[model samples]
Target: MSNNHGRVINFGAGPSALPEPVLEEAAKGLFNFQNTGIGIAEISHRSKEFTSFIANLESLIRKQLDVPPTHEILFTQGGGSNQFSAVVLNMLARWRLLHPEAPAEEAVMDYVVTGSWSKKAMEEAKRLGGGRVNAVADSRQFSQTGKAFDNIPSHDAYKFSRDPALIYYCENETVDGVEFSHEESSPAAFPFQLLGQSTEKQLLPLVADYSSSFMCRPIPRLADHAIVYAGAQKNIGPAGLTVIIARKDCLVDVDAAARLGAAPVPIMLSWKTLSDSKSLYNTPSVLSIYMTGLVLERIDSLGGLKYFEDLNRRKASKVYAAVKEGQDRGVFQKKVKDGSESWMNVVFEVFGEGAEKRFLDGAEKKGMKGLKGHRSVGGIRVSLYNAITEEQVDTLVTYMNDFVAEETKPKAEQ
Candidate 1:
C-alpha cells in the first residue's frame, strides 16, 4: 500500500476525512489557539477569544449557505440523533403555543422516511409522545423488496398532514445511500412545491436532517425550512458538535409552552436557551468547534461552496460511472435507484462468491480504507465527502475498474 504519512484515502461515512492542510493547522491550534498561550481544547468556551471564534464559525456557515436573517445558526453538543427528539419537543411546543386548546393527537409530526436515518427520527418522535407521528411518504413501500430503502418515493405519493407540527426528512441517508436530488424537476427531489401548496401562507415547519450532506454543496431553498441541523463529524469536523440553522420563530419559549399545557422540555434541549446564551448555555465542544472553524475557513479560502459543489459533483460522477461500468459487466449491483442515488454515499453490491470481501480487501491493500458499508445493510459504501479530492476519487475509480476487469475474466483463461 502506498503510504502518505500513514494516512489512507478514507471513505467512511461519519467522523470522515478532513483536509490535510486543515489538520496541520489544527495541530498547531491544539498547542496554541489564536495566540492565547493555551490549546483550543484547554481554552474556555466563554472566553472572548473562543466566543469570537465561534461567532466567526457561524458567520462562515451563514455567508456560504446564504442563510437568511429569519434563520439563526446555532451550535450545540448533541449530534443529529439528539435533534430528532429535540425537534419533536421544540416544534410541538411551538405548535402548542399556537393551539393552546388543541390535544396532543391534533399535533401531527410528518416524517418523509426515505432511508434509515429518517425512519429512526420518526421512531424517536413517536417515542417522545408529545404529538402524532405520520409517515408522509415512506420509500420502503416503493422499493423492489417492499422493505429496502432504495428509492425516493414519487411526489404524488406524499400525504402531508393539514398542519403538521414539523415535516421531517433526512437530506441524505449514509447507510442506505439515498439522497434527494437538488434539481427541482427530478423525481428524486424533495417535494417542496407540494409542501408549499399544502401549507398555504404560513411558513412551512420543515425540519431537515442534513448530517451526511451538510456543507458539501449549497442547500436547496435554505430559507424555506424552519430547521436544518447536521452533525459536524460527516463533512466538517469531529463528532461532538451539531450545527443547527433554525428559523427565528421556531426557537419558541419552551417554559411558556409548558405553562400552557405542553410537554416540559429540558433546558439543554431547548433551542431558545441556546440562542439566548449565544450557544454558550453550558460548556461547548471546544475542540470540535475549533477544528470545524478551521475547516470552514479553509473552505472559504478554496472558493467556498461553489467550488465544492462543482468538485464533489465531478468526484461522485466518476465513482458512479465506475459503478455503472461494473454493473454493465455483471460484476456489481447498485443498491439505490438511478435518480435517488446519493452524491455523498454510493452503495453497491459486489457480485460472485467472496467478491465483496475481495473488493474491500483489495481496496484496503491499495491504501483506500472505510469502503465497507454499514452493518445493518452490508455492501460496499463509498463515502465521497468534501474532503475527498478528485485525485483521491480517481485513484479509487481506477482500482474499481481494475477489480471489475479482473472479476469478469474467464475462469478457463486463469
Candidate 2:
C-alpha cells in the first residue's frame, strides 16, 4: 500500500494547512526525534532533550514576535476557548490584589465584541463569575441588520470602564472574518488610540486572542499588552498547545486573590504555574509542541514574518479583488465591511440558486478544499493562512473569476 497521499489546497480556519516542509520534517520526528530512538510523542516531557526543544520553541516565538523581557512566553494545553475562562480568573486575580477593598461588582472586564469568538469569550467571562463582563463595543451595534458582527466598530464606539480589570479583544475573528487594521493611527486599527483618551488615563490591562492571526504579521504595540495568546493549530501546527505571551505583572498571586474574596483560580489554568515551571507544570501536548517548533524553524528559514506578510498581502489582495469583481457582476456578496476584512479568512457569498454548492463543487474538482463557510454562518470563507502559497491563491482567484464569468454569462451563449 502506498503510504503517501497528495495534499489539497486546504483553507480551513484552524487545524488549518501547515507548510509542506514542516509536515515532512515532523513526519521524521514521529518515528525518531534527533536520532533519539524514542519518538517525539513517546519522549518524556521532563527529559533534557524535550526540555531543550520546548525552550527553543519559546525562544523562537519571542524572537519572532520581538517579545520584550517584561513578558514571559508560556505554553499550555487548552486552546483559546480554555483561555476564555482562564483569562477572567487570572485577570480578576490581579484586580483583586489591586483593589483589595473593592466589591466584586466594582470589578469590570471590557470586551470588544466584533465577531463570534469575542462574543463567546464574553459569555465565558460571565460564566466564570468574575468581574462584570461589559460589551464596551459591539460591531453588531453598527451592523445595518443589527445582528451581524461583520466589522470592527469605530474607535468612538468603544465604551470602556474607568478602571476595568481587563480589556479584551480578538485581533482576528476567525468565524465572521473580521480583523483590526494593522495601521496604528487608523480608526480601523486596534482601539489603543481611543483607549489612550480614556478619562482614567491609566494604562488599562489589555488581553487579546490572536488564535487565527498569530505570527501572520507584526503586532502593533505588542509590548504594552498584559497578555496575548494563540492556539498553534492555525498557521503553525496541531491543536492542543496554546502559546501565551503574558506580562510578569499579570501573573499575579491567585491565592492572594482568593484571600481577598475572589474565586480560586484553577492550578492548571494559572499562568504563573506555566511561567514558573517553564511550561513543564504537568504533561503537555508533546507532539504538538514538537511540530510547532519545526514550523517555527521553517518560518525562520523562509526569511521570517516579513516575507510571509508580503506574501499574505498579495494573496489576500488577489482574492479580495476577485470578490470585488464578482460583487460588481452581481455574482457574489462580501460579508465584512471595508478595512475590517480579515486577511486570514475572507468570507463572501455566491449569488444564485444552489450557487454555494456549485462553488464548492467546482473548487473541489480543482483540488481546493475546506472553502465551506462556518456552520453558524452559511456562505464561503476562504482562509488564507500562512501555509497557503501565492500559487494556491492564484488558482483560487482564477476559479473565482471563471465561476463568476460563467454565472454571469448570457443564457443564449450557454
Candidate 3:
C-alpha cells in the first residue's frame, strides 16, 4: 500500500478502480488456481479448472443478487456497445414474432434517454434495428433525474400496432461523473419509473445498459419486463468481457431461422452458442473469469447485496454532505437539481472558472487523483465504487473544504 503510486484517491471512470481483495486473490492464483499446475491464464478453458471458475462467477452473481430461476446470465465478448446491436437484433426477433402483422422493416422503438450512452444506444437501435427510436428527455450532461423527456412514450401506439418495445433507462453516466442511487425498488422521496400506460402482455422487454453501476448495487428489477446487460470492465473484472442477463423466454423466442441458419458467427459474439455450452464456447478468458470470480466472492463476504447497499449509502453520504455544506457558503456548486443527487458518482462545478482548476491542482498535491471530469463535460466527478472506502471520501472532502477556505481569504492581507 505504501508503494502505491498515482492518486491516493482514484476517481477515474471505467477500467478504473477495482477492490484490493480481487486483485490480491487473482495474483495469488495467477500461477496456479486451486493448486492446479497451470495458471488461470494458461489453462485450457474446457478443462475442469476453468469450468469451476465460470461456475463460481455465476453462483456469486446469483447468490449476491438472488437472481430469479427464470433468468440466465451469459458472459460474452465485446462491450455493451456491441450488445446495442445484438439486443435489438435479438429483441426485435422476439418483437417481430409477437406481432407478425406489423411492418418488420419499419418498427418504432422508445428510449428513455438519461445520458450520452443511452442516447447513443437509442441511435444505434434505429440504425441497426431499423425502427423509430423515440428519445425521451435527452441532455448534453449525464443525469440521474431531471426534466421529463419531451415526448412521453405513447402507450397507445403500442396498444394498437405492434407494441413497440417501450424501453426505459438506468445508467450511471461516469462521463459527467453522475450516477444512480436508490435500490431497484424504493425511492423514499421520489421514484423514477412513470409508465403512463398499462404494461401488461403487450409491453416489450426493458433493455437496460447498466455499464458502470452493474455490480455496485443490487440488481434492479425492471418491473418484470425486459432484460439487463453490462460490460465487465469497472466493477466486474476485465475489459473484454460483457455479461447479459435475459429471461429464458427471451432466448427461446429468438428467430429460429438465425439459430439454425447457414451463417456462422465466429464463436466469440454468439450468445446462443455460448449459453448452450454454459459460457464455454471457445477457449474462454479463463483469467478474466477467474478474476470475476474473486470479485464476486469478495462482494459475497461483505454480506451480499443489502449489506453493500447500506455500505454504498454511507460512502456516498460523506461526499454529498460535504459538497452541499460547501455550496451553502458559495464555494462548491451543484450542476443539477439537488433533489436528483447520485450515490455512485458525485459531480459538481466550481463556483468560478479558475476555482475548478485550482481545486484539481491542490488535490493532486495532496495525493488525490482521478478527480478530473470526463472530456465531454468539464467538471469534477468523484466516482465512489464498491471498493472505495469511507476514509478516502472523508479525506477528499477535507481537502475540498480547506481549499475553499484558503481561496476565500481577504485579498488585502496578501
Give the best candidate by TM-score: 1
lDDT of 3 by residue, 186-256 (tens): 33211234443424454446667777877777765543546788887777787878877877766643545
Give the per-residue lDDT digits (tens) of candidate 1, residues 125-149.
8898987899999999998789999
Residue 194 in candidate 2 has what lDDT? 61
How high a TM-score does candidate 2 get? 0.97
Each candidate structure's TM-score, on Cα atoms with residue i matched to residue i, is 0.98, 0.97, 0.86
Q: Write the candidate numbers in order of decreasing lDDT.
A: 1, 2, 3
Residue 325: error of model 3 in Å? 2.3
Instruction: For model 2, state the Cα shift of residue 259 in Å.
Output: 1.1
RMSD of 2: 1.9
For candidate 2, list the clashing residue pairs, or say none: none
- Candidate 2, residue 342: Cα displacement in angstroms equals 0.4
For 66-102, candidate 2 gives per-residue lDDT tens digits of 9999999999988999999889999999889988999
Whole-structure CA lDDT of model 1: 0.93
Write the number of the candidate with greater TM-score, choosing between 1 and 2: 1
Better of 2 and 3 by TM-score: 2
Best by lDDT: 1
